[model samples]
Target chain A: MSSRREILDLLRENARYTTEDIARQTDFSVEEVAAAIEDFEEAGIVRGYQAVVDWGAVETEDERVRATVELNVALDRETNYGDIADRIAKFPEVTSLRLVSGDYDFDLEVEGDSMREVSHFISDKIAPIPEITQTVTHYIMESYKEQGMEFGDRDDDDRLSVSP
Target chain B: MTFEPADRVDQVPPSGIRRFFELAEEMDDIISLGVGEPDFTAPWAAREAAIASLERGRTSYTANRGKRELRERIARFEADKHELPYDPDEEILVTAGASEGLDLAFRALMNPGDAIAVVQPSYVSYVPDAIFAGAAVVDVPTRSEDEFKLTRDVLESSGAAEADALVYCYPNNPTGATMTGDELAEVAAFCREHDLVVFADEIYADLTYEHEHTSIATLPGMRERTIVFNGFSKAFAMTGFRLGYAMGPPEAIEAMNRIHQYTMLSAPTTAQYAAIEALDSCWEEVQEMTSQYDRRRKYVLSRFEDMGIDCFEAAGAFYAFPKCPWDDADEFAEALLQEEGVAVVPGSAFGEGGSGHLRVSYATGLPDLKEAMSRMESFLE
Candidate 1:
């Protein structure tokens, strides 16, 4: 098995699995595991590790809300989808932006304190873009699962304390 | 209150780790590396099959020899994976678990005063089971110098070659050592020369990491003399289901079933149904789990190496037996558990030959293993 692939899979499953842990799991030296991860980072293959959070689970004065904004852009000959997508991706509110196929040219997930805030960001920031022609914003009602992790009850290890 | 228990029950002591288990039970947040079974659950398809069986009200006892369909699948599995062809109709007898199958084999083969040669530093059940069968256990200690493998010389030098029968387990428990086909062929030759009835406990056969497992029954002239015990407990992660089978000559299997019909009546119908599904469609899941275990095996060994502990390379099974730096592994394990909250089985718990070592299981998730290693390093320091 490929050591890099093994390390990648472990990190993908649980990012908290450290380099030392990866070394042990992969039979790679600590230095080798560190170097491989460094190579991955340097090559831009591993962009970043972000925690999958459930914002709704936390009680706060400013409850965070997320929405998916479908953008139908009419790109000029001079400005391609990359230029328009890049402009949309630069916004701090856009958690994920994809140049999707089908009816919408781009699917962007935006997060804010409220639905009105997200709507304003789309109208104020996204709608004013030169290539942007039409926008449809749908506020996310609830998130039961995200990034392959379920938001509800996680499976607990129910094995015995010890056994032969 | 003054009544005495039977000699057979009283003579054999309880499991060596009973005290350790009690101690661990009292402690809080202890990372245990002591379990001898796989951490994974049975595959979804298997569970579904059992549930489906229950829904269909097929909960009655199976045939004493087991459900024929399950036996047929076992036959195919044995033939495909180990190259040992068994007649599902005549040669396979399903029992509660490999533990029960082993006990049945011991009872069927050994008479009073019969000496059964057993490889030491082996599974905990073998010696006691031998005793229960009214047999004497002749210890055949596999040397650590040979990575705990039972070589022909080991058998010859020890009194095992002269014994009435021999019990062999590889991808060994506590040690995680295994033998190659050629190595097993050598032992097979020894068994042939001695006319020894061989009871092969290959419960961990599918979990071998380095090479494919070779059943002793596959070697020439050995099938008639060997009864191979295997189960879904380890390989298919069906420990709680309690499904296992013994494959051997018709007469031996019949002997085992004769006892089984009266004792267990049948392996649980639900487990039999589940095992059928497991053998039918769970090969891919089994392979996935085996790969996971292989990774953990490497990880545990690597940690021991970093700690400067002299651990033999465990080519199979999900354990690492590292030589303890302290004078007594039992003391070391106790102190480590009390102070650092990491639980590992002292090697002495396995047998006399397992003294001054520790069997660290890697069935836990990586995080706990890492925490335990760090705690062990501190304990060593």
Candidate 2:
């Protein structure tokens, strides 16, 4: 009865934990957890587990700039936004895409080596799309929290317990 | 002859729940529904205060009674939340945990051969703590048929009327049973008539659902004789912080504080600061966590009903005690673990009255809880 999504959530939180530990947390047997994880791997529900990196902290000459580009689109009568969403998703620079319910019809997160490179990609590549109307790009200044995790934080949880 | 400890200590059995946990430790890959701790962490404001205090190097102990500001806030909190006014300086002793608070209260109040009536299917600490303090524990079974209320009739029938003091836990552990104010007023009347001191463990007070928790101390003529225990562990999700407090008349608080000073010295200073911050601003977090638990509770109960298992709907705490048709609780618990890799505490661990039942904690994630239910259904079928 445990959902594939729940198992994925646990792996997302801490992938290094053992199958036994995951089972203890998720109420699945080790065999069941192992099987579900195997199914996830086969079905592509999980691609890979990797550490989230902060290049600003480690890299000496990091020049990467990322921006969220909101697109106001005119949906065609045939495939309303699907064709455009597919085309946008195909871009290597696009990190995220969502059909949002705000002033914009689609949201795309794009990254580049510099601001100029990003603007060039938008104006040269994206502006040519016939169904698109307007594009507003917002550059991310810094990230304090991402994916429900606080960055650059000290480990503070394992101390001060006398009982359960 | 070897140096010997007190015979009474040897006479009492180790907690039935302890054996299962020890067994669980020897293996891996078991999904545990037996853990009593909350799944949430202490809220951010509280954690921030603790971090700030550590950076400021405030690691030294506070006064034996605890920090003045924390005690003052607790006093105000009591008055505001429970309508029971307590003098901050004279009537509260902060302990390392509710466990220590219970230990201190028992040692401070019990005389050898004194009798303490403890409700069964209750928290695990009361009986052994009383025994260690040289008191005889009288079992007062709060039958499931009665929805787990310890009424005057239940007390009298179980010989609890003869006891000198009573230990009561509402929003009770294991069973998740709670008593309404009208129900507790009857207990207040009975204790008054029988001249019994009441030890009220309200640790789960803030976790109450659908009904407000009623502290017996606020009942007429009960404040002077009732010793109330509460802590941040359950509501504020600060179990690891190790801070809890006992509130009572000045004499009882003084006795508990004397024991507290000797054994624990003081609760960790960083934790005290964290607790003070939590006390001030963690109500919103408490509400969010409580509502999440409510959703899980309803879901679990509905799952049980769908499976046609008999489960008593709980309005307090995070546990659900369901009656199983199995003849032996320990056997069922063991079989479930062996066959399905799912672990739950047998009801017999709570007390003899809890035999033939099982206690499941909804403090776990929803997916796993659902998995456990399916496992149970398959096992039962």
What are the per-residue Cα lDDT tens digits for candidate 1 across A3-80? Answer: 578888788888887787777777677899889889989999899999988987887898898999999999777999
Clash pairs of candidate 1? Answer: A24-B299
What DockQ would candidate 2 receive versus the native complex?
Answer: 0.07
Q: Residue B302 in candidate 2 has what lDDT?
A: 73
> Isolated chain A: TM-score per model?
0.91, 0.84
**Local distance difference test, per candidate?**
0.89, 0.84
The best candidate in terms of DockQ: 1
TM-score of 2: 0.77
Among these predictions, the greatest lDDT belongs to 1
lDDT of 2 at A64: 84
Q: Alpha-carbon error at B187 in model 2, in Å?
A: 0.7
Between which residue pairs do clashes occur in model 2? none
